[model samples]
Target: MALVELPYNQLVQWVIARGKTPEDCNKRLIAVEELCKGFFEKHTSIPQDVKDMQRHVHCEYTEWYEILCDITERLKSTEDGKKVNFIGQYSYEPLYDADKILRAFRKNNLHIVSYSQVLQKQMTFNLPFIKKGIESNNKELSDYKARRAESLRKLNANINELQNRLKVYCMDIKDYPFNEDFEVCLKTRLTQEIAIKNANMTIHNYHRTLKLVEALDNEVVPVFKAFVKYQKMDKNYHPEETMKHIRQAVKHGLEYATNGNEDTEERPSDDANAEPEEEPLIQIVKDDNELLVAEDKRRIIFSTQLGQSSFRQLLLGELLELLSFVKVRIDELQNRSNAANYIFSQSGENVNELIMQPISKYEKYIEVINEVIEILSGTDSMKALSILKNRSDLEKSAQGEISIWKRCCKEVAEQSDLDKRIQVTTETLKRFTSDLESARKTIKDTKAKLEKATAEVMGSPVKIFGEIDNI
Candidate 1:
């Protein structure tokens, strides 16, 4: 029986088996079926009415049949044709209009064709080259997928391990936070927060990188492959041909490549009606460089602390509150020293000021805390943080756990990963202090104006917009 006479499904299976891997056989079969159905539907003249087709009176069917058969044979054939074992001994014979397959070969040298108009001037097609190119893309895509999966596995493992460690840490400290229902001290809380936040940030970075990788594999790469398939069909089909027009009509199609599914088919063009001067099919090699660049970009984003701004902001807020609490403690100590000095004076003895140095140090920290808040609220928290690191006290603290709270605060502030947050904190404080100074000036000016208005209005006794002392 002639190839055209074969059932559509059987023909698709035959074509797919010729060149496609068994893994993708089912997927390609579905694609071929959709392509064929779409082609037949559009070229109703070729298939004719069912009754007319059944009557075997129309010659259009023959042309259409030949085109389909040619496409199938081209898809299945190797560059240098060779006999291969199937269920039985079979050979791929180039069907009529085999020259149309040149389009497929043209796709392999897309970059060249795009660069050189001279090459595209000639109607040249190399089938074997196209086949090799497709195989190469498949292999690379496969390899990338493997690597991506491995990366995801490792990232997930790290995240899980960190989570487990955090869980254990929490359990260990759960009872250590207090004795006899006493409130947890800031040092203990700060210590736990610092450790937890560090782990959480690492996990966040891994998750973010993993997501980008998934996007490349699952979204970008598939789209790239679909474009290749479309180009393969584009060469043979003329943009003006009924089948091509039909395919293009449904360019945003429900079935086939239009659906944006990996399993969907590529769009087909009609070679017979295609313009001779039209550009040849070109394939864009899915660059491994693109993937590598994306990975590098991901690393940069996480490295600079830009990727998790929201989380860092929350942490800064916590630090600000803790610093405020520290300031209050300093104030209390200062008040106690003042009281002690007064008592010593009453006893006719002098006492050196205690806690004055610590109080002064904490006052400077309060200023830093204010600057950090200001930086976080600004447009460029990262830059602010980076610049603010110069004035940071986190790294200036004396080494060693002199006190539980001091150690925790020092560790948290000095942590390399948290340096960005400290910087942001200081910057925020600077901004807030500036705003506060400006507001103070504004308030002073307003008070002076109010007093002046009161004087002028009382002298006039009938002016509007002035506060009356009685009211």
Candidate 2:
């Protein structure tokens, strides 16, 4: 359901019905009412936010970081060359260079949150209320894939495909081959005058015949019938091509040996006391066109993941300015509230009116967000990549903080309710005690009256009995 603006009364009732006391409810009422009224609907890209960044960059703070310095330098550059084009008198922002760098990453599948998407996020968080739930609604495919892990079969398939691709990439790009070590011994021809050795691989003087022994390091390397290594001693030799062959051969040697034309079926154990056989690992290559894409996911996971973090950090930096503004405004309101409370306290009138105030925070609405992405730049892709790596941990921390906050609110409400119940119980006990005392006093007075009446009758009764005896 769409979240329309709820009235103050509705918010009050909503809070109160959830075990919150009226005083506590009033404290929360303002925030929820404002939310329902679209007070926070304005995106961080407002002119005020821009101005605040301008002001912050202009000021010289001792604690300014390296990234902040670069950003401020960009801002200061605005004063020098604020021109987009000579024909058009377009101006540059202090963050103009940074903005240019940010745009360069558009081809990256990173989400650049616009001012409008910020509003959409509000609705996105309400996904639990959506019709499709989480199976598939509007979440990006990349986001879904990033969060979920591949199944064992899929992962094995991917590993197999990657191994094959490496072999293909090496052999196809250059004349690099599956290089291996060969245990070779010289076969010498004992002639009458001169002795000659056979050429195993390297071309040598008086060496012609080449013979191959069993493949050396067969356990570690694939059991190839023959292996080739090309090495040019001339100035035309390329070290990069040579290194690629070496790296690929070493990395995928075991993989090729395990899967390349080997019997994969498990062998039956003949001896019971023999060492337990390990579970055989089999890899299946699937025909998936998705892997045919030009984008390299491995590179993205390691190095090319700047776009998302840059977008995130940029949005965060913008929001910090807005948060700083809100913090100041809230502080002013709090000071005013304190002054009003002090005035009320000075009045000596004895009254039992409840005067509970909600806990006043001087800093941020969500404190967890304050520590996120302090000062990120588009230039440092490494830093951005690092931020992307810790996405899961950051998510956990935020969710945990939110969960703790919800628990704390619920506890506060419960405590308030408990105090109220205890007070009512104490009052009932006092009234019962007072009534018991009054009843006791009345019982004592009636007993004294009965005693007096009995005594007076006794005093008269003695004479009556004497008169009867005389009669």
Candidate 3:
């Protein structure tokens, strides 16, 4: 049977199976059936009105169609073959008309092709994608929303369980954690301390370097320039001119030292007394990680005096200290890795309780949430999420406990694998170490130049930047 002859439902199913939406399939099917019915009625009806068509007593009303088909076939087989339009100066060379019948019908105003062809282009058609029996786009989207809601439901529950566990531990946990039950907890706690310290030291050193750089520009060189000007010594010597260039170089260097990036804006403050500020959020940014992951100790150091900075040095002094801080952090993480390895190896075949035991019920709890985020992975539901945000200090309070468990767990259910994290951290540390001695020579040269200028002005050489007790 012809495709147009199929039942209405069958046609809809066929169209739908070819990736058309159910709504589209049903609408297009109704129109196709109407067009096909009209076409059959005209093609099969007796010719009653047109005198030319009525005179053809050849057994059918549409006899002109068969005659045209015959004419088209004979023309193609003979020298009626497609030829260039020599009438147009042969401008269409090699692009001769392929269908003589189509143009012939158009020229004579006699078109009786497939009836469906007239309105077919008005509708949209799609190729096959998913299998048949799938629901419409609206239904599928609704299902996704339900699944996403369920996932969030589970996510909140798991986060709640994590909060409860941490609360219980914090309320009852000993300061030293002398109990064997807390041995694992103790190690994670230590890891938190180390990370926070490392972060503080990095910021402290960075700011100190900025201060020293600023001192060179604001205090040291300005004082030297004044002394040179007061002495009226430009006639014989022009060391002040050299100092002016140094002042300019220091101004540019200050930008790099403060922000740790190319931007000239001031660095984000890490001081305890500074007003709290939030990182600006994009309206459409909605990654599961934005609210899910706990803040590590490194990020926490900015608000506390855990890493305080108060020192002076040459232009690159902050760069040197930052590198030094990274070295210490790497050493600490390496030690923690070794400790983790030892904890794993201590039990032999029986296995250590500290290594094999569940850190808390939160592990299994988070397991349920693992698939929830994925359900919403392709969704924008997170844009309106405030489950974590609405609570009072929940995000901040959970940071310590959540961060500790992360360091303790070798395999977090939905997070990055522990081994991979260690490998990446180690590789990064190696890169920093390779360039450790970079500014040593530059600082040495800068100090010699400064000492000579100061001695000529004040009889005694002054150490302008490094290890000086006074500003």
- lDDT over C-alpha atoms for residue 255 of model 3: 29
How badly does each model clash, as a count of residue pairs? Answer: 22, 2, 0
The candidate 1 region of ten consecutive residues with least summed lDDT is 114-123
For residues 1-471, write the lDDT of model 3, one tens digit per residue.
Answer: 111223211332333354423434334434433432333234432222322333343321222333344434443444423443557422221112213333443332223111112112111111011111122333444554555455455545555554466454343333433234555655444333323333333334334434444444443333333334445655764645544433433443222233232334343334622322222222211253322212332233222221122212221242233234334333433567555435335334433332333323223223322322222221222211222222223334446665544433322222333334445544554443332232233234433443443234334433433221111
- Predicted candidate 1 versus true structure: per-residue lDDT over 205-241, tens digit per residue: 3333333333323322222233234446546633233
The alpha-carbon RMSD values of the candidates against the true structure, listed in the order shown, are: 49.0, 49.2, 41.0
lDDT tens digits, residues 1-471, model 2? 223233222332332354323434333333332332231133233334334444433322211122333443545455444556566533553344344433332222111111112223222332223223322322333343333223233434544443453342221212221111110100000110010000001111001100010111121111010111121232464333423322322232112122323222322122312322221112111143111111222122222212233333434443355345435435545667665344334323331011122324324232422432232232333332332234332233234323333343344445455556555555554554554454344334333332333233223211111111221
The deviation in Å at residue 126 for candidate 1 is 85
Candidate 3 has which clashing residue pairs, if any? none
Q: On a 0 to 100 scale, what is the lDDT of residue 402 in model 2?
A: 32
- C-alpha positional error of residue 69 in candidate 2 after TM-score superposition, expressed in Å: 99
Which of 1 and 2 is the better model by lDDT?
Answer: 1
TM-score of 3: 0.20
